[model samples]
Target chain A: MNCRQARDLMSAYLDAALSPSLRQDFEEHLQECPACTAELGSLAEVVSLVRSLPEKPVPDGFHQLVMTAVAAAHPAPRAAKVPLWARFDFSRFGRVAWAAAALVIFFGLGLAAGRYLFPASAGSTAYVPPSVTAKPASYDATVATGGNTVTDTVAGIGRQVAYSAKMDLQVQDVRAAAAAVSSLAEQNGGYVEESKITTGWFGRVSAHVKLRVPQAKFQATVDQVGAQGKVISKEITAEDITASYVDVTSKLIALQTQEQQLLDLLRQTTSVDDIVKIQKELEDVRAQIEAIKAAIQNYDSLVAYSAVEVNLSRPLFPWLSVVWPGLGGP
Target chain B: MGPQSPENREALLVQRCQSGDLEAFGELIAPYEKKVYNLAYRMSRDAEEAKDLAQEAFVKAYLALPGFRGEASFATWLFRIVANVCTDALRKRRQQEVVSLGRQVETSDGEVMLELPDAGAGPSDVLEDLERQHAVERAVRSLPAEFRLVVVLRDIHGYSYEEIASIAGVNIGTVKSRLNRARQRLRELLQDGELFEPHNVYKTRAPSKGGAGR
Candidate 1:
């Protein structure tokens, strides 16, 4: 081989990468060429020197550190099951926004307090004056002198006892049951004092009834009304109005007496100024007597009857929507 | 084991180390670290860089042990890694063109050249001359990047052509060719007039580039 060709093949030969025949040819060339042989020797020495260098030791904690990193990358399996709210860091901007919303709600409620919750004081209170000014107070006499009054009229009614109850029912037909309850009140010698009914699709049906049953048949009336449906909950309350009835009755009598006196004064007065004053006084006393009579009637109605509130609902059976996979073909 | 039975002990250590025993791994490295470090030092020409490369190789080998597959001997694999790391360091240094971390001193007569600061110095003093050291360092630094890699891997690091090929990911033929070209360049560096005057005289006497008298 020429020098250039030999030089090119020299590296492969030194590496023992040549075939047997090729290696033989290289050996023959080397034997005939001292310069090439010398060059090969120098290259061999270089390879030897490089191969003789020392090996270094690995640094400490390498395995532990790598394992620690791996463990962090793949955490314990239980971490996936934690709820998002608890897992999320509340220290972030989301937490700040949440606090801001809460602050706004509290601040709004604090501002609304003055309008809705202010208690009146004599000077601090702002009362709206009427369009027509109030007339000044006046006096009158000689209308009734000493006779039957409003208080004597209210005291003539007998004493009464009150009863109330709250009942929760589950009925298939709320309207039918409510009608049946009203019919039962009439049959038991009672009248409907107050009655109301409200209906809607969202399972919230309720009826309120204040029925005055004859005092002797109160228990029987309650029992017959309760046979309507399954009762989920119940509450009953009873009170006697004997003392309040008597006191209101006597006060009503006193106001009627004053009213009769003012009416007699009006009849006796001849001058226009005296007559106008007497008529105003008479009207005021009569209005007070009317108020007392209305109060006594309200108390008598409450004491003689029982108010019942029935909360009703239709049964709802919950079901999950089932989507059958590929069952129906069109 | 007794000193006379060192070969048997070494074989036993190799066996145990291959079986994944950490104590055996430590024993295997203890006797070889210094040799590996020196090889790395010559190739990288920096004590610190060599040490780091050597350590990196050991760590790499340890991490790769589980997948070693035992295709070649463990020592051979380790040497391949060390050569690779040193080559990588050299390549990085070359890209940045760093000079004089540490290099040898050679004389014009093809001998290592060192100069003594004082005329009348001790025997060790002559071996530690700064001017001669600088000259040798410049000669090595002046080599082309490709030639330098082959020379450092083969000559300074003492890697076999096959090991160099494995580490360098080249065929053995390429390694040898590169080494030859590197040697030619190194010889030229040693012979250059600027390097040493006596080296010029030896250069004329030395055989030319071609085969002898062919």
Candidate 2:
């Protein structure tokens, strides 16, 4: 073998790890090459020198020491004894009996308190006293236009709810569609609450609009605006806020009266600094009164008009199915 | 039966031990404790550590007695477990401190002296022999743990290659390779004049086998 090959197998040859044929080849090389043979001899010597060291026996009682340690650490059979003790006294804990009785009494008291606080939660009572109101009839038909669900009414104040349905239009300009929808709301005597445009990759743009329309023209505006593009999805929920609005309106009147009384007190004050402080306090009260009035007015506006949120996509990907609630099958 | 027919007795003890007889297990371990401890001591080169490792090995074997497949002798399996435990102990010790081949001589007066080879061996014939033996022991201790283990099993303990492989978790070829490397290393570590000297134990062999020289 060449010097390179000999070096590669030298370790294995020194280890006596070569196969018979390989061993033969290595032996032939070693016979021919003095340097490799010397190297092998040195490696072998190193291995043997390491192996010849005398072994010192363990000290006396070592087994007992280890076994005692293992016994202390593991103690396997002790666990089995626990079950035997448990079998002898299943209810040995006297305190547990008292605790269990206390738990039962506490649970009973808690149930009684819950029954008194939330009487409506108890469905077993069938007594309909005179204080209770009459049952209302359920809504039958729904006008499923755009993404809004409008219910039919016969006599009671019609609770109209409107919501905008966003869709991707296949048109060239999305801004034009947004302007058209805004104009339609204005023509219906409706006002736009919020509108914004967001830019996309490759000069694409999407428009978002929140608008309010009178309850009377709610369905008509939705139908007119929905004709713009593919409707993606919409959700509409309406609440009968007539009673809540009336309550708030009455509260607002009370607040205005309180503000007027405060103003009168401010005017009658004699001390200069006190008058200034009272006037400041009166102005604060008046500000709160105005805020209350505005809130009531806003609620009235919502009750009178319906809100629609319209999201317009740039129609980047077409030929995709769009399903909107109340716009499809039952 | 041959004087070495402890096999039948061992089998009986093993059966009882398998049945969870503690006394039987003690009996089973009693005879082999010295051998196991010596093997562990050789591997770890520490008396106290060897004892602990050997005991743990036996206990592990005791717990696993039910699963002992009788394909190999229980001694063979026990030796392997001790070897592995000793190897681990030695590795842990190496990590803790560097181990040199410095001699630790114990005197009859209960004194211990740590000295180098030349220092312990004064320029006298008796000291020379002791130094040579010490040198051989130091060389064996210097071997890599793997080759050293094979030499201990083969030469000192006289376990066959198959038994060594079983204990070492290696094949017979690996066992042979380790043995050869260990022997070669031992030979080199010996003074050149001492390499050709034979072991006294081989003197009893027939002439058909090469005559052993000392």
Q: Please tell me the TM-score of chain B in candidate 2 relative to the true structure's chain B.
A: 0.72
lDDT of 2 by residue, B109-204 (tens): 353323333223435666665665666665566566787788888767867777889999999878876676556555544533243233321342
lDDT of 2 at A76: 49
Question: What is model 2's DockQ versus the real complex?
Answer: 0.12
Residue A38 error, candidate 2, Å: 4.8
**A318 in model 1: Cα distance from truth in Å?**
24
Give the distance in Å from residue A9's predicted Cα in candidate 1 to where it truly belongs: 4.7
Please write out the lDDT profile of model 1 over residues A1-330, one tens digit for every residue.
Answer: 755667666656766777899888888888899988876775564444334333444333233222222222333322257777888776775877998979998886665454334433112322222221212112112122133443234435454556666665556677787788778778988787667787656755766665666655665665666677655556666555556566556656666666677777778889998888678666755665666567666765565455655555543331100111111111
Reference-based TM-score of each model: 0.35, 0.39
For residues B2-118, write the lDDT of model 1, one tens digit per residue. 765865675676666455554465666666666566656656656546655666767666555656655766566666777677777777876685444334356444743223211
Per-residue lDDT for B29 in model 1? 64
By summed lDDT, the worst window of 10 consecutive residues in model 1 chain B runs over: B113-122
| CAPRI-style grade of the A/B interface in model 2 | incorrect
Candidate 1's docking class is incorrect
* Number of colliding residue pairs in model 2: 16
